[model samples]
Target chain A: MNADPTRLLAREMAARLRTGETTARALAEAHLDAAERQNHALNAWLVIDRDGALRQADAADAVLAGARRDGPGALAALHPLLGIPVGLKDLISVEGGQCTAGSRILEGYRAPYDAHIVERLRDVGAVFLGKTNMDEFAMGSSNEYSAFGPVSNPWDLDTVPGGSSGGSAAAVAAHHVPLSLGTDTGGSIRQPASLCGIVGMKPTYGRVSRYGIVAFASSLDQIGPFARDARDAAALLHAVAGRDARDSTSAPVPVEDELLHLPESDDEAVAWLRGRRFGLPREYFVAGMDPDVERRIHESVAFLVDAGATVEDVSLPHTDYGLATYYIVAPAEASANLARYDGVRYGLSRRLEGGDFIADYLATRGEGFGAEVKRRVMLGTYALSAGYYDAFYVKAQKVRTLIKRDFDEVFASGIDALVAPTSASVAFRFGARMTDPVSMYLSDACTLPVNMAGLPGVSIPCGLSEGMPVGLQLIGPAWSELMLFRAARAFEGLTAAATWRNLEPAQLAEADDAAGPTPAERAAALAAAR
Target chain B: MAGLSRSDVEHVAHLARLGMTTAELDRLEGQLNHILEQYMKLAELDTDAIPPTAQTIELENILRDDVATPSLPASAVLGNAPAREGDFVIVPPILGGDAG
Candidate 1:
């Protein structure tokens, strides 16, 4: 059977696979074909495991055939993510697969075991589509920090896809694959999803397992998914979200069926929005916001209000300090987490004639880490240094508490979730934010507060701003992913159910030209110009 | 709110066990100072009355039962080592070097 290019979402693909309308090999071939055609120019994917993916597809088809032969007993073996081609961030280990974490230091290392989430996905028959690039050690707000080279936004190749998770976002938005996993520590996933015009979510800190993910900030990092819409993201999350003994911090809370409970009709979705209260944090709409972004964020809020939700002007008093707090906390944790990369251990090691063990250690890290990674390591070292811990690290932690309090106070007073812009602007041209570090930090201004509070937030594309995608963010208190997903589903069901694929960033406007005009179309246009 | 000096960056880099070139040190001195200068905004708030939150969730001292479980073999653990001899990692001489 012929497949519609635009209708290849993970949920739809799985349903078709279960029915025998399409085979797993067929689905894999289509995505692999697109990935091969699009990956070279996009640079979103770090590696494409074409052979491994097709092998997995063969296994999935066998499983489907087994189900067909065994009747209901075998149908019970089906999973939401079965037969789906999912991209993994370079930071997540895949058991003997190359796991780079986008740093030269880890480039030579291969993982010996799968991360908790990877194991979960693997158990359910999910197909791996190889690793995607990321900001080195998840330290930058733009993909430019990657030692492997930056991933260009598919919207405009001259611009950057927002970082740490930029590669995963671009892969999904460009239609190379239907879904990809991303890790968020201080807005990494949501910010990129915004810039790339797709759906990305970061569950409440402990809501997902972090067992084999390369540690950035132990307290802040959480892995989630990027997809074409909220439904697919929820389905992917359902596959991976659960408690794990390997991750000491994984929450014991049960995962809910948010995707299954979603409203079936637009009126029900509007009614679903009716009684929920949302706060528009005043500080998030600061002078630093781009004019187009500000306008689009307001439009998103107005859309919610028109659908029977109440939007209020709320104060997250310490929202302004979240950026400063994250800079200190994330780096301090990173400095500690990265301390294992000595010459005696795994990864690249540099040796010099006069240098002893310590010198060897210094040289190995110096040669292995990129400039941004070094900058954060030094900053963190200083923050936690003997004389400055109280003034810097402790103070940052206190502000972090205040940030959490702001969210708690609002949520306690009956607000369901918060609404805000995902970033200060849209996808920016390369080298735009790199000149000054502080300006680059400002890009996470609106999204970092959620991490500070251990809250779940989802970014769904609202509209285009300045010819690029802009996202509307929904954030809720701890273990509240179900609520956030419902709200996102409501908003998506209203605006995107009928026309989203056409409305997204990657394959919309200039793609036809980039894909290069069909010969006939080019000829007709040239003839018309004459 | 003050910027870091060249010596300050050198000291921090040394503490972090990162060997830096003169050019990298020079460039980082400015960028690190700019970043720290931005972080100075946090000093403006009065956090004296508040307790610090090292983690957002209230989790501490997560204890596991004392039991022997299967562990990764030595070869798997050492598979990614850059330099190893007979299952033991090899390093240079330990004495006569600046301690990190």
Candidate 2:
């Protein structure tokens, strides 16, 4: 208990809780205090439920006390995540709480019931600190598209924490919480984790049920975990992943128990890396990649080679077509999913007296959605319109097949995983890519192909590039999450004593200053300067 | 793949049921055209033999038992309705009126 509880990993905190050195309530209080104090500058959280978190923490404490009284068998049956604090992306439903999904359309809407993941987390006795900010409808690469405000990276207050899971990434990166949940459509989780310097994984499609989570691009969307390290991320993913009868798409594959017990010793973890074959996708290192980022990735590959792993250059031939294919497919699905937001049902309603329903629908959606959302909806509608379906929507789907085949061929060649940079560049300043839509989309170039292939991918901090964190991504074939986590854990062990591993977010002290300018103020000042 | 014209943009917006002002439409025309240009890259690949992949996983035709379960309370479901009466939500007239 002598160590700062907020700084300890969730696993370390679990160990503390087991030995009676600290209670769940104390850990929750420490995180909530840090979140509340730092939120003025970070703007990471949309709402921090102080009362609700404490209630959950007290419940966890009671269970811990009872298990202690009931002897060794009862204690052995407890979940490791019991009493851990977690941040949830605003898109995930937590009953009776606001689920805005960062859009004005859902500004005041409260979820009627818990999402499948929320139910799972609650059953394991995890504390929900609050909901975090995100891009509206999970549409943008930068958090600036959020109607509420942008999220500032903990490393540098001037730069963005990548989106649409920016708030969750920043919350974990800033030590407000050890773990969080985020949904990835096309690099929403991995890109943000790369920018914020944390661990994020997008489980294979249908690996995690999406029963009550907000729909972004139905075919591509998957909920995943964000944590400071691979083991904690693996633990979070294990708690929520598996079959759910409600979501027909949730795969029936057995949830692996090995996720809960990743190799703890350095030697054991490194042994998993030896003799593993990794494919370095030549296409992932594109022309616009920052030299600093390329250097870090090469250094990481060399470290893997030194540990008895083989790295070879590989080609995903259809990789260039991935961006265009994803843009069409995701938006087309989004348009259909978003068509439910008419004036009558649940969200914002803009009906005028005696006005036709068509006008009402038009007004409600037009005003409710932000610029980026409207853009996607417009593109989708145009593509799906008459005389364009085959040329756009159907063509994107066919191209998607080629993208998947690229990954399949590489994995078929006996490659255990594909190693690549998570993002082409480090976090950029706010208002940097805001003006050009294509530039914003390019932020996810290196990571979106995995989503297209429906494979599991993880991003872990490799090192710093130009004083900003660079992420090394490992993508594996479907249902290879256990292998992916083992590899990520091995990399963590390999780089444990590196100088950059000891570094914390540079601007965290500034974020803690009460008088500092809020993210909204900084955004406005930047706009004025432009 | 030609760029969308102003009238085309307006028509698509109408189909999507989104109200757009002249300024919004004007900006959207350029933006949408730029994005369509990006989509033009998909044309470079000849996927005539490739099958379209709508869903990535192998699981399909998932079915469950017909047993019924308790549903959400009507009160909770209706609580979010913008305008509602007892067990009913108010809506604009769908017939016998000018559509716009």
Candidate 3:
């Protein structure tokens, strides 16, 4: 098996395979081998399907051969991602495999059926390589909350790769897999992608189906993708997108593949960015941002300006309250979503023979969760509890509305999209801010507002900061994924040659010993740590 | 606001169903209370007439039809269970192994 084909976009890989430059089976084998080599160091994959992937790759080859001889549409036509290897975040259910959600509570649990998106991916011939790790039950800002151990940044082993989609980001960044799916409730996808220096997109809330995804905060959780670049992310959004009866909230719109074959005409491209206004929300330039990060983001603004996109200072006055409101409302909903995990119906049943059923419930949950998960559950329960509801939970909801209104007002002012630093700073080394939950939560300050307002957002590799990657987040109004894609692609086109040239991962044995254990040892430590 | 009593910590742990040692409990109590206090600032704002917005976007009745869909066989769904008894999921006994 060969290492993963690096820097090549997924669509390009598929096109090459279709054009007979490479075989699907060979590509799949290469990716699987890469995933295996990288998995031991990054702790990215939860499973590796050596046999299953080969079978699918062979099948894809057979179909493509037939299609070539028959000349287009002679064989069953599938999406361009057909038979391409992809990774799934463990939190979502896939029919036969385990859906751990990075928790010991569901250690060996499997789903009865595939998630809506999983099924769609299958329809298009995407191969499921394995599940990726996440913050336990999608509850934390850092992947450290996972019972599976923390996912390390591939670019710099000592630093965190963001979460709760940290593993997805790491897998793609390390070139283990070109594309992987992740979910974003509140910056889960974008933050990790930013930290890891890759592209991650959270489609408008309902753009992708959430039918088989385990609930965290149902209203906010939207399944998205992490990829090497914006084009691949857009390709994934095209492949597994649109309405499904399985997910009631999946948007009821016709699926569009137009995003995949974007016109190369500069006039058409510039028109999309220039005719469209870009908003720079004044509030996201928070007080504690690293100066290097601010400098890099300013460079990103300059890059966009060079691409013919105009930027104007805009106001989202309610942005200051996004974090507080998200924590309150998400946890309150989480309390409801997680209520089903009691001992009786599913997961880690504890029987207290002499005690009452209530006692049994208490004992079971007591042993099931981690500290951060429990703390949030308690805070959520308290917020939604009697008497406290009006003050905490209800007020938070009102503030959420005002936050959404803030986005509406800015978009109403003719802004095509908004751009900002994806995080306050570049990746932090392990244990740097783990003990401080407030500081950990603050890392998501810039990315959280998009999720709060139920909008589409993408994180693209901007410039570097102190020799680490920084991302410029591009946010668009609901269902404006295409617009966001165009804006990002334009910026990417200009700065593509620069940035990320210095991001060579020092091999496990050679990495600074102060960074912690060797990559392989860290991988095992993460598994055992879980 | 940053300080939390041992009993309060125990109570919260009870609700969350996480067992904690004395040191861990003490640490968490102080940390949780400090975090909670930061959230208390929302009380200063007046939102009397504003209706609570549970979803950022006002997408009402966005439910799919209650239709039966294709499902994997029962064997696949239960393939990874740590323990199972017949068609039912089996979990560790809270009191004793024989309880299940």
Candidate 4:
């Protein structure tokens, strides 16, 4: 809202780069310097490509100069993020780059080819700032389970930033990179983004290519942008979004130019109920939800109502089944996906002699995986075990259908989108959920249902409680990303509070230096730390 | 159904791979059982008529047209392998006796 160049969004930053106010090389060098200085405190980046980045930035400058001589090159070259710095979650592959997925098993594993999204970003001249930390294999909600080490909250070091996309959120929040991509399966992106107080989008399933993103839950993983705001996120989406031949599940549609010449709105949000409808799913307001969070949701709804959107109480009785269903389905996929990590072909190989082939498989996997990853693999293996398959895994799948149907019913009933608190409460302290696995899983309650239903969801800064950020989630029907973006933008516009905007480095330093045992090195650090 | 036996815990540990002490296994068994029990909530729902959903988006014919695209050079593909033998990406042998 202010005219300050320092706080300008990424889109504005890119515009200045294109206008030659600052060269792409200068912006890259400055951000790289900032990242290097802050990395000791933040621990957000797994690798910062000082040499590779400068080379890429120099290339972008050359491209921009040539484009000036001619016109902005083709759509591939004229892309908005052409020279912007992007930190990718290690889960996504970038050819010739180390893609560890924040795991010891994947350590030193360089991809032979770029992921479809990586290819797009490279074609547009995006400077890759290497990989950010994530929950190993994208299994956890908080980023505490990374093999690289826990990424501290940019706001308060005592607290978590949020996981499995915690590093991406923290990097963007701390201004290390203006844009980063993270995969969300069961609130991985949105929850961390919410906790970190930045913008995150989990596009409708298949909206973004998942070809080279390391599988956690194949069915649920969708890579989306984490940016300063919705408009910049929309622009990043335009550059990297769309179908890819590598990802069969990618949507067969053209990327949306949704942010072009977008009109500015002064009013935060006027919840116009004239013809638009918003549903408040009762199941989202569970017992353990913080009272402060409930209050913020109420305020957000009021702001939406003032912005002219109609609000009504709705029932998603099947919502209670989501956590159970997610655990089963996600683990089942995790089991199948992680089977490739046997030390034979790739990953860590332990030495043994005269052992049975199966024994070697057992030994290699046992040593390669961390405790949490093993737990999920075991759960998945058990669920898909022959005798129990019909009972557990099959049953979970059936429940998943019901969850999707619940959303469908509401959308069909005239509601353009549904709104709920992104998480039941604000972020907890670093070790709050460490020993409580069930309670930890339950934190995804408000966010998981959207992924189950394959709907587009955006978590925008709605309000704050107890000095931490709380996000209001807006969910739209399949392929209705535009509507979700529009609604979220409107709500984001209406909320004049800068409560969830940025995190200062002082907060990170305080959290890291405070008296405490050194945080878990890697395995525990992978889960998002929100 | 109940807390894991020492042998069962050992088996899982063997399957997962970090060397754990007996105390660590005992603690893990307790935590894993508690989690497995909580997840049993899926067993309560009657999903008899519902269809299993592997993917939420409804898209048809996900196959791409068969086209011969340019391939990565063999050098780049095997370049980063920690252990490589000639044209092959060498690995620490699966049978794992010693350097092969």
Candidate 5:
């Protein structure tokens, strides 16, 4: 109770709730207050549902009251996430709430029903703070591609929080929420988590059902969690991951209870790392990696080595091809998934009085989609066009097989997980990589291969680079989320006493300034200055 | 690995049902070509014998009981429609009309 509730971890808040030291309503109010007060500068949330969150919080309080009246067993049976405030990426549908997917096309589209994850979270009594901002249709690497505006990294007011789950990362990083949900197609979750300095994991493909959530790349997209630590991230992942009959792709794998019971003791957690073999992908340390970022990753790896883990240089030879392969594969799936955005059905509509349906479609789509979305749709269409299907789409898929094989071979060699830098560099300033799309795409170089291989990957803060946070990523084979979380928790245990681990995001105070320029204003000023 | 020309960009945009301005098309032509150049790296690997991986997780033919479930209310579904007439959504003429 002495510490600020907003700054405390969700699990800590849950513990407080269990002991009657704090109420769920008090926790929800603390986060909502911070989120609303700082939103002008951070722009992390598109909506902050004060009323809805309070309602959920009150319901949680009632449940706690009932459990208290009963017995210790009933109280202990409560979900750890009950009463936790969670910010959902805009694409995750909450029934009757706007599901923009960060696109003008979906500007006013209220989801008719809750997404599967939303239903799951609601069932566990997790309070929904509101929808967070994101790249339009989850296409861009920088949150700048969001049609609404960019999300600022709480570490630095002018820098990006990474994307397209930027808002979720920023929200958690800025302490607006202790946990949030984000989807990863090609490093959307991990890269932003890296940029914002939090724990993020992209569960193995189909580990989490996608029914009712907006689609980007069908084969690659997977929902995951963002938390300040690995255990909380694991708990969030446990809440929503598993089979859903609606989404045929949702794997029927058993959700692990071990996820809920990650070792809490520092000594016990560190022991899990002993004798575990970690592979450092040689291709991940590419030419343009920032020196500070590289140093942090190496230091983290050395720490693992010192802790009795064997670190070996391994090659995911097809890593260089990940960028190109992902560009093609994701955009192709995006184009197909986005075709439902025609004017008449739902979302933004443009109808020329005498114009035909094709014209209506053209006008609606052209005007509705943002620059990055349009570019992706164009690339996808051309790739799938006549005389080019084999040369492009099919070719990309074949190379995807090679990418997956690279991970398979390394894991087959007794490597428990691959350790690497989550992002090649720390968070960059807004408009830094905006002009050149390829440069922006390169932001995800180190992490995208995991998505290509359908593996579970976690990005946890290792240390700081140039006064900003840097992430150390751990990737494991498909359905190895439990192993990855264990490794991440072990790394957290090892780094618990480190100076950088004790530091909060630097610019949060500045983000609380009510008179400061909004993220949109800052972006416009940057553009005008350029 | 051929670069997308201005015409190719325009044609593809049309096929994708996007009405683009000349300036947008001009920028896209160059950008699309540059991105394609990145895809050119995939050619470095001869994947002739490698089977394409369309889906990664190997989940096949997921089936469930055929029993019908209650669907979303028509009113709820229609609430988002831009133009709706009673139970149906209105659309621009698609057949037997001048292609404007």
Candidate 6:
């Protein structure tokens, strides 16, 4: 009770609750206070439900109090999530809560029902602190496309936290929440996690249900978690991944306890990595990337070498076609998924000065969508239009087969997981990647191909690159969450030697700031320019 | 050659049911063409025999028992509609035929 719950991990906070040292009500209140203080500057949260969160916390406190009558053993059964404040990326619906997905098209809209994950979080006792901001309809990489506002990285305010899960990752990095959920279509979660200095993982596609998630690109989209460490990410994933009758794509497999297998000591962790073979794709280390980012990724790879991993070069040859293929395929699916938002059903609808149904449709869509959303929807519509289908969508899918094959060949060669940089550069200043659509698409270069192949990839912070964090991505073949988590935990342990244990962004942002608002704090200054 | 003309964009916009102004159409025409120019790279790959992957995992029609389960009540479903009358969402008059 003497310590600030904000300083502890979700699991640690839960441990204190188990001992009755603090109540969920107190922890939730502390998080709400932190969110209020930082949210104005960071733009991380879109909606903060203090009353609803407190009500949930009160219910959790009651559960804990009832269990305490039995003993510590009974309290342990309740787990640490019992009252832990977690942020949901705006895209994920929380029944009766606003679910805009950062687009004006859905402005003023509220979710009618709980998403599968929301239902799961309710059962696990995690409190819904608020909704985090994101790229409008999960389209852009900078988080600037959000109709609400851009989420600034806690490490440097001027730089973006990456997108479309920028707000979710930034909130966690800012310590507004110890954990938050984000959906990744094309590095939406991992890329932001990398830029913000946190851990994020995209469960193998279909590993988590997408029933209540506003669909962007159905085939590539996935919901994952952002956390401070591997164990918390694993725990959050466990709470959400399961078979749901509502989502036909939900995997029927069991959610294996990946964290239970983590080594308790550094020596054991290193020994665990010694048996595995890691692959580094040459394409990922290409020129034009930030040299500091490149250096940090290789440094982490070297740490893997010290752990006795056999590192070798591999080729995912179709990587060059990945961005192009994704642009085609995603928009094609997005065009279809977005068709339901025609003003008649729900969301913002600008009625034209006419009675024609067609005019109403045009006015509603044209006015409601943002610049980036319109660009993508148009691109997808063009690709799927008659006479262009074979040359575009079909060709992109054929190229997709080649991309998946590249991974298949590497895994066939006995490489357990592919280790590479999660992003090409650290978080860039606002408007850095905004000017050129192609440049913005290139931002997802390192992470998108994994989605193309339908593989599971995890982005874990390795160390600092010129003070900005570098994320090392570990990718495993289909259904390799266990192996991916094990290796990432090993690398996360190696970071301890570099003082990474104290690298929480919210804690570091205070001291890391100097001269005006640290580079990370510049977003607040730039907001006036917009 | 790949860039769309104003009319081309207008036609496509109509197909997509988006009402774009001259400024937006002109801007999007250039941007859309620029994005499509990138996809020309897919032509470099030879996929003569390969089939397009429609879904990532091989899927069969998922059949559940043809039984009804509890569904969301009309109230919760209609709660988000911008303009609603009774259980149905109200749209502008469709057959009136003329612009105001």
Candidate 6: residue A237 Cα off by (Å): 0.1
**Model 3's chain B TM-score?**
0.74
Model 3: residues >4 Å from true position, as ranges? A1-7, A72-78, A264-271, A353-355, A499-530, B1-4, B16-19, B62-100
Instruction: Residues A1-530, candidate 3: write the lDDT tens digits.
Output: 22245446687678777778777787788878777766655777777777878887888888788788997665435577976888899987876678888887777676777888888888777877788988899877668788877777876775778898888888887776789999998899999988888889999988898888988987789989898777788889988888776576777766666788665554555555554568888898999889899998888887677667788999999888888888888888887777777766556666776645556666666667777777778778877766778778889989888888999999988888898888988888766667778888888889877888889999998877766788889999888898788887777666656746435543433322344464445645544664
- Candidates 4 and 6: which is better by DockQ? 6
Q: Residue A508 error for model 5, in Å?
A: 0.4
**Which CAPRI level is candidate 2?**
high
Q: Is candidate 3 or candidate 4 better by DockQ?
A: 4
lDDT per prediction?
0.85, 0.93, 0.78, 0.77, 0.93, 0.86
lDDT value, residue A306 of candidate 6: 81
**Candidate 5 structure lDDT:** 0.93
For every model shown, the clashing-pair count is 0, 0, 7, 50, 0, 6
Q: What lDDT, from 0 to 1, does candidate 2 have?
A: 0.93
Q: Give the per-residue Cα lDDT of candidate 3 at B59.
A: 56
Ten consecutive residues with minimal summed lDDT in candidate 3 chain B?
B91-100
RMSD of each: 4.9, 1.3, 4.0, 4.0, 1.2, 2.7
DockQ of 2: 0.82
Which stretches of model 5 miss by more than 4 angstroms? A528-530, B98-100
What would the TM-scores of all predictions be? Answer: 0.94, 0.99, 0.91, 0.91, 0.99, 0.95
Q: Which scores higher on lDDT, 4 or 5? A: 5
Model 6, TM vs. native: 0.95
Deviation in Å, model 1, residue A335 alpha carbon: 0.7
Candidate 6's residue-wise lDDT over A1-530, tens digit each? 43678878888888888887888999999999888777767878889999999999999999998998988788867855788999999988888888999999898998999999999999978999999999999998989899887777888777889999999998888888999999999999899999988999998987899989999999999999899888788888888887888899887878886554467576766678876899999999867999888988888888899888989999999999999999999999999988888998789877767467788898899888988988888888989999889989999999999999999999999999999999999998887777689999999999999998888999999888778888999999988887888888888777667775576564334523333343334544564576
TM-score of predicted structure 5, chain A: 0.99
Q: After best superposition, candidate 2 residue B61: deviation in angstroms?
A: 0.5
**What tens digits encode model 1's per-residue C-alpha lDDT throughout A330-402?**
9999999999888677898888788666788888999999988998899899999988899999999999999
